[model samples]
Target: MSSSRSQSIQGTLPVIAALLGNGFIAVLKFVGFFISGSGAMLSEAIHSFADTANQALLMVGIRRSKKKATNEFSYGYGKERFLWALISACGIFFVGAGATIYQGINALIRPQHADVTYIVFTILAISFVIESGTLIVAYRELRKTGGKAKFKKILKNGDPATIAVLYEDGIAVLGVVVAFVSILLTELTGAYYWDAIGSIVIGLMLGVMAIILINKNRALLLGKAIPEEVKDRIIEILEEDPAIESVTDFRSAIMDVGKYRIKCEVEFNGNALAKEMFARGALREEFEEVRNDYQEFIKFCVDYIDRVPRLVGNHIDKIEKRIQEEYPEVVHIDIELN
Candidate 1:
């Protein structure tokens, strides 16, 4: 399968798993919240609901990213994932985290008499089952992408949707614990406000995580650099080409929609025109080989030059200087072959 096709499948798989998992948890939590008047349980329910919605958005993004480039959209929709990822962050913060915190604060300020032990316990139990399933899917996906990295490294370098799912699993698991503690505390002290406080704390955490996801996606949308290893690999491939004498400079950019547009400047020894063509073709073929070997490569351009070809020189210093101004990369020279 093409690397792009494989990546597309990989991206969509996790999203499907997350959506299914979160959907089940949402239904269970909704029922649990209804049975138990615990404000914290209600907040947790909203969190799961928001996660379900976010996963749906992520799935849409992943699918949209597969659209081919068009005249109106030259770079294609690969970066659509980043855009939707940003929007998902907003929903998570506003709907999931915001609502939870709002309700929790209200409960704390105005204590209520609501028994929610059954709802809390049952929902938490179901959450474990659903979230675990989703987390397992995510881990499996990670392994395909090169296994799990350090937490900080993953946070810095991993895909936003993948990272967001991880956040969901971790937070959801912790929220369960927090809910259990709050329920026990309220039961022991008969202070319903403790449950509310627990809910509020969970909400705040979710909100913070959502913001972080947003920021992370935002950076990627703005065109972050490829990983160092990938950069080095690209360089190695270019250097290995026999036609390329030495690479003077290599630069790359991430255009909208996750397309990599690269430019390189290299110095080479004078060679026959036919040999140059052969070498260029060979180098491009090598590039294709490398791209196929690794999944991350997008696209590139290579310029091979033996020397700065002078158009006007010696007696025509002024003209040479003028030509240089117009085309900085070119040199000016005049040749007379009797």
Candidate 2:
């Protein structure tokens, strides 16, 4: 679109690195948590585990969304991408934020001094670097599709999977920063509650990220309409045809992430159709054959009128083909007489 629009931009980058990085970081975070018994480290571990789960869920969606259309699902399984995204949000809410917050509260109730300072710090340093690397990769891939596109554009029009990768990596990086600060504070101040507070803060961040992801995915899963600019472009394409005088009852909705179904009623110009037939010399030959007899002319006129629907249908097919040439995302088109 020339401007703002809500449509999924489909791609398959930024997933592998984020998935693998999260998986590796999750193991290290758990190791640090068990060794140090710091609430912040434990929270980071849970966050990383949730991220690992997110990768698995995203992979599930990517695979399932590729399934061929079935009788029961005539539109195919494209929405399944958003389906697992929704599920990942739910997982983040419960497993990531919920567990982290609970652990924070538990640590607050029963505070414990952390141990193995150097090892815990080393783990956090590595986690931060890994998460940041994943974030950078995700951003680079985003630029490939977005290319100076603002965050608003990506949020409104990006593929859910890519969005998940970028957003999750971002939150992961922030979570690691919070974890590092909290642990460092605990080490300097000897107050275990600082670690607990860090845990709670990380949980809050995940909660917010989860909510945003849930809402975005829900809109997509429910077949959100394409942007107004997109609709106007299609309409303009239709009206550009001389045979189409006007358009009415235009409607479009997502069939898959990037694909759409468009339906509309078009007012065809009878004179234009006749002119087209004249240009083809089909009507001139018929008129020449019937000019001698009034009865034969009436029969010919009746036959010509009877085939008007087929004539209009042929022109519509051509228009549809042109539309496909102009906008390939328009996979399904339904043009009706107005």
Candidate 3:
């Protein structure tokens, strides 16, 4: 398979894993909550359900992003990934965090004792194992793209689908741990309020994660630029050509995951053009004498100016070809002569 196709498959794999895992875990959590009457268990159930739906939404975004370009959207539907990711963030905030917090508060006001503590513990253990599996898959995928960067930086700059799955599963694991601790504390101290506190903490964690995702997707939708290192590499490539005097302006924007559009304005070396014209015999000392004759000089100047554009065009073509070969992520490149 091509690299892009491979990347697309990689992007979809974590979502698929999360969807399947969460679907199973959600049912288990619901059963645990019903049997134990634990607020934390109920909160975890809601969180799992939200994650399952979020994965589905991510799949939709991935599919839509692959749609062919139409006249209405000449840039294709790549940005759809960001749009759907944004929607997923909203879902986590409202459905996952908001509901959990509200339930925790209600439980706090009216304490309720949990029954069948052993069953809750069993379900939490199983959920942890399942969530850990998904988290492992996501972390591997992230490492493939992230290299040695910090986890937070990777999430900020990585593909939206990968980031979504990574964080979702990570939070699920942490939620399981919190739920287990809260149940243990409540059972030991007989406070019952500890379960509610766990629920509230889980909700607050989800809220923070959702906000981070929202900001990242928002920036992407607004046309975030490629990394500084990437921009510098492109500039270095452009400057490598002897015909280019200097790059006057350079701009870049992310068009999709691992895709970018770049625009640059470069000043051509006037001396290079003069040398080429001299070597081609289009510009000669004879032209200097022709300057004394207005019509002749006009004709000579026109012919020389016409050849300049052709040379410039050829040079621009070479530069563009080199850039595209060197940077496969650059989907579109616009080079202007200054």
Candidate 4:
């Protein structure tokens, strides 16, 4: 299969896995909640449901992002994933965090003894194992893209769909732990508020992550620039070429997860470019033969002048090609002569 198609499929793997895992865990949690009337278990159920929906939305975003480019959207549909990720973030805030917190508060107001017994433990254990398994899948997928770099750096530049799943799965694992502790406390002290507290904590965790995802997606949608140090490296590459004097007025923006475009004004080293493209020994010999004949010399000068622009154009193409080779993510490059 083609690389892009393979990449697109790879992008969805974590989301798809999370979706299935959460869907199953949601069912398990609901069953546990019904039997034991545990608010924490109910909250986890709701969280899983929200995650399932959010993963589905991410899948939509990934699919739509693969849409072919058009005149109306010249940069292609890469940002489509960011738009969907923002929507998913809002879902986490409202549907996930909102409902979870509201449930916790409602449970707190009317606390009740819950007989989770040992069955709830079994359910939570299963759920925890599944959630952890999904989280591992996400981590492995991220490591594939991120290599040996720190996870923070990877997430800083990772795909939004995959990153969102990673965050959600992490929260899921933590939520299970909190639920386990709250249920244990409930069994120990005969106080139900601990269960409510666990729910609230889980909700707060989701809220924090949701807000972060929202802000992150918003920035990416607005075409956030790549890191300055990376941009500096790109600039350095351009100026290192002898035909180019310096690069200025540089600008860049991410077009997608791992793709971006750059624009800059370039100052050419005129004498160096002239010598590289035009000052050939064969040309010098030809010029010497034509110097004594007025018509021939005039023709030579005219032909030389005519070829200059084409040669310059070719050189510019070469420079641009080299820049792309150095930074493949620079899918588009615009250079203005200064």
The TM-scores of all predictions, comma-separated, are 0.75, 0.92, 0.90, 0.94
- Which residue runs does candidate 2 get wrong by more than 4 Å? 1-11
Write model 1 residue lDDT over 121-208, tens digit each, in one string. Answer: 8678879877877887776666566445665665676667777787887788888788778877888899898989989999999999
Which regions of candidate 4 fall more than 4 Å away from where they truly are? 1-6, 285-289, 295-304
The CA lDDT at 196 in model 3 is 96
- The CA root-mean-square deviation of candidate 1, after full C-alpha superposition on the true structure, stands at 13.7
For every candidate in turn, the CA RMSD to the true structure comes to: 13.7, 3.6, 3.1, 1.9
Q: What C-alpha lDDT does candidate 2 achieve relative to the native structure?
A: 0.84
Q: RMSD of model 4, in Å?
A: 1.9
Instruction: Put down candidate 4 lDDT per residue, 208-256, tens digits, no spaces.
Output: 9999999999999998998677799988988988878888689989887
Mind giving the per-residue lDDT tens digits that candidate 2 earns over 76-184? 8888888998999899999999999999999899998887479998998899899899888777766666657686775677677777888888998899889989999
lDDT (Cα, 0-100) at 142 in candidate 3: 85
lDDT-best of 2 and 3: 3
How would you order the candidates by lDDT, starting with the best? Answer: 3, 4, 2, 1
Candidate 1 weakest lDDT stretch, 10 residues: 329-338
Give the higher-lDDT candidate: 1 or 4.
Answer: 4
List the candidate numbers ranked by TM-score, top first. Answer: 4, 2, 3, 1
- How accurate locally, in lDDT, is each candidate? 0.71, 0.84, 0.89, 0.88
Return the lDDT, model 1, position 319. Answer: 31
Task: Give the Å error, residue 13, model 4.
Answer: 1.0
Q: Could you tell me the lDDT of residue 237 within candidate 2?
A: 91
